[model samples]
Target: MSAESPPGLDLARLRSRLDADRPGLVTGPLSARLIEGGRSNLTYVVDDGARTWVVRRPPLGHVLPTAHDMVREHTVISALGSTAVPVPPTVLLCTDDAVLGAPFYVMDFVEGTPYRRRDQLDALGADRTRRIAEAMIDTLARLHAVDHTEVGLTDFGRPEGYLERQLRRWGKQLDASRSRDIPGIDTLRERLSARLPNSPAPTIVHGDYRLDNLLVDDTDRVTAVLDWEMSTLGDPLTDIALLVAYTEGEALGDEISSVATAPGFPPVRDLVARYTATSGRDTSAMGWYLGFAFFKLAVILEGIHFRHTQGKTVGEGFDRIGASVAPLVARGNATLEED
Candidate 1:
């Protein structure tokens, strides 16, 4: 045992801790890889020859205090354990920084594909594609339908002023990451502020919900809804609207839109209708919500663009992100004009 940790993980330390806390949890040696190390949090997969588990921790180096709270992610997932929502089972939660130099949690590994391309769904055929899309919405409805109070999540977040706070928060994020002026960015933000829709009764708002964020098994079942770094009690419509925004852009030839171009993924209108009927919430002001979603996404992408400029970003799509921003801000303004 050389006491050397593989890149992004102190496997030796992790193994020692697991052996001390829960003996037999890790049999044999351990290897880990940083699977998803993006804006929200860094995720890794650890395998012990026979069994595997997923690990989540804050991004290396610069970390936003409230953005990637391991305990918050652990808390929400643990709370949703009994709900119809399919989340990976928690194996262990370690908040102590000594074990891994940062707080992290381990959960049962979920086997599923996070469909991020229309071509991927196209291979599944239209029927299966539609089924998966429908399941995504149904699961979202089921999640929103959960009574937070009864689930002991009443204090998970302060739902009051959630939407307003979100607007201010993202605006600050954008300003902090600003490198250049984005056309129509301020206009879109101002319009969203001017016409803030009266939010419905708050439910769990998965801050960044979309197809790629969900894992669908071969049976077309959403085995787990991954990425709870942004989960909180807030206007549920924000989640739905972000879904619509991504699909809407994809349908318009936007590369980052990712899904919704398949033959039978169902129309955005149908999806909205399904959510309305399933969740029993009025979606009349979805246009405003969708526009707000666009603004939020534009800001997010711009922040990524800034990071990429500073050579702080990892991955391939950074070059195209700045190109995506102006169009999104423009679309956000246009979407608000809809009836």
Candidate 2:
């Protein structure tokens, strides 16, 4: 075993642990590379010559409380493996930090493309792009339809007062990562707090549901939904509004995902209508949810910006994250005011 390894993963220790626990999973020495495009949790694609898997761990430093729980992520993904949410199959969950510096989990890697930019969708043609987007909406509807209790997720999260708790939670997350003043953020939060919309029946919500978080196969079907660090049992409408928010103003930011900006992507109203028609849930109050979605995204990017400033962030595109926060705040405020 060599002393050299990726920044966060020690290949020698990882191979040793996997051999001791999940024997024979790896046939050769482990090599890993930190996967890019993730702004919160650190993801690595590891291979052992014959096999490949994904490793998810927390960021290098400045980790906010309850933000990147490996057990929570592992549990939900494992639980949803039996459901129709299209999560990767769980291999093993290693809570022992002696292996990976921080808590991390391993899952078999699925084959698909996580389309991030508009150009990628452009190559797929308008009809294919429309189908992919529609498939994403339908997949989300299916996830919300799953019975959490039946799938051994009865205590995954508290559904009571979910919207209020989310508001408070993200607000505190923003405070935790505040390195510089983000103008209009406080006002946006206050406006969202003023009139909380009544949430429908709670379901398993992928807290950060967006196009790039999903992996699509060549046939225009959503093969898997990646990044479950923010998932829990909560208001399903939050997922819908978050998806809409991602597509709203992404054209202005270099690092922001612009998959929705591609031609033939369905508009917000069409997405909402498709979701409503599929899930039978009303989205009449999405105006406020959209505002909160922008607020949440702003806070997330601000946290990444803070991490980048502290030299705790890994991978590229982090330098451009801070510039995107103010625009999201402005959009959030405008959305709330319009509502």
Candidate 3:
């Protein structure tokens, strides 16, 4: 091993672990690069001079450890291997921090596009873009349709009071990152806290479900759902609300996160209707969920911003994360009040 290993990975040590655990998985010298960063765990594309795999690990010096449970992410994905939801095939899940400086998982590298910007969707054209968006929603409904107990996930998460815990958890996270006064943020929290709905029957919830969090293949179908660090047994409608909230927002700062803003993407109402039709669940009371989604995103960006300010954030795109928080908080307050 040289002194030039990447910040979050030690290729030599990784090779040793893979050899000891799985044997003959690597073919040649290993290489890696940070492929995703900012608010969530760090993702990297590591190659063995022949095959490539995606690796996920906690962000460098992340504030919360429980939120980035690599074992839980791997467990849910591995459990869903025989199910309808498309997830990258699991190759390895390593918890021994001595190998990579932290726990991480490796899975087969699936070929697809995350389609995070407007121009990317524009290139796909209106009809194709619409189809991909529909597929994204349909895939989510299908994921919600899976029975956790049958999939051996009966102990994955506590279904009872999931919403209340989320509200309280994200509220504390927001307070932890409060560097400046954010108008209407406290009011938004209060309203969500007061009007919390009795959650629907719990299912597998992808805590942050959005177009960018999914990979679409050439057929415009969702090839794989990435970033399952937040997946758990909880109110599945929360997943729908978060997706709709991200899709329907008019302003999410100056960032080019406009995959949902691309022309011809179906309206959020149509998405909600489609989900309700497919999932056979009542979503008339989703307004508060949408509000909570906005609040959750606001707090997430604030946490990223706080880390960026501390020089602890590892990659690009974090410069504007702080600026995006206030607008999201305001939108959350407005959404709750509108209903």
Candidate 4:
């Protein structure tokens, strides 16, 4: 494998490792380019003219404990390869920092587009957009239907008290990233702590499930579900609620993905209806889950905001990330209040 690699990726060492571990995979010298639009992990597209694959590694600096877990990401994706869920086939998981200065994993690069803007969806027209949205929901249903035990992920995560642990986990994440005041954040956290919703039968939760995280083909099929950084065995409703929260659009501001605002993208009620019909999971508690989703999103955005403040983040969209935190906090509080 060999091109002049990016700052975090050493193409030469990667080529060496691939040759040693997965012989004959690389046909020529390797070249790699960082794939943008990912905020936490560093993803790069590596090519040797004959084949293409993706490499995922943790961020450059200021990584919070347990975040950007390459092993967990690789494990879950590898386990799900034979399931109904669409995932890129993993090549190898390299824990030797000597290879990439961080633990990383390689997967076949599925060909598809990650539509991050409403304009991009608008170009697809209303009917196609609707089909894409339906496909996205259908994919989620299929994922939630998978039995963790059957896939050898029985120890992946503690499903009991999953919602409670998620709240605490993101709370600690927020504390670790504190740099400025965020309105209603503390209130939202406290209220969330005061009343935790009961979870349904556990499923493999896609910690961040939304349109942009998926790669869609020209036929509107979701070819692959990317970004398993926070995936676990947990309440499937949380996934549905988070997807609903994303479809709310602009909660993270225009700089971030707002593809749901695109015309013909189904409404929240329609989204929930589709999920209910497909997954058959009761969404009666979605109000509370939506609130939790907002809180989680706020903490996530605030973490990014903190990283941006410290110049630890890469890519173009981080400059405006800080400004988006307060609104997310407010939205979270409001959602909980309504709930």
Best by lDDT: 2
For candidate 1, give the lDDT: 0.83
Q: Write model 4 residue lDDT over 1-339, tens digit each, in one string.
A: 346778799888998999999999899888888888888899999999988999999988888888999999999999999998999999999999988899999999999999889899999999999999999999999999999999999999999999899999999999999987777888998998888888888999999999889999999999999999999999999998888877774645875578888899888999999999999989988888998998898888778878888888778789877787787778878888788
**Residue-wise C-alpha lDDT for candidate 2, range 6-84, written one tens digit per residue:** 8899888888888988998889877788888889998889898788999899999999988998999999999999888
Off by over 4 Å in 3: 1-4, 36-38, 254-256
| Alpha-carbon lDDT, every model | 0.83, 0.91, 0.85, 0.89
Report model 4's TM-score to 2 decimal places. Answer: 0.98
lDDT (Cα, 0-100) at 246 in candidate 3: 77
lDDT by residue for model 3 (58-133), tens: 8887466367889989999999989999999999989998888889999999999998888888987999988998
Q: After best superposition, candidate 1 residue 221: deviation in angstroms? A: 1.0
Write one digit per residue (lDDT tens) for candidate 1, span 31-137.
77766424446677888877898888876554543667888889899999899999999988898998888899999999999888878988899999999999999
Off by over 4 Å in 4: none
Rank the candidate models, highest lDDT first.
2, 4, 3, 1
Candidates in order: C-alpha RMSD to true structure: 2.5, 1.5, 2.0, 1.3
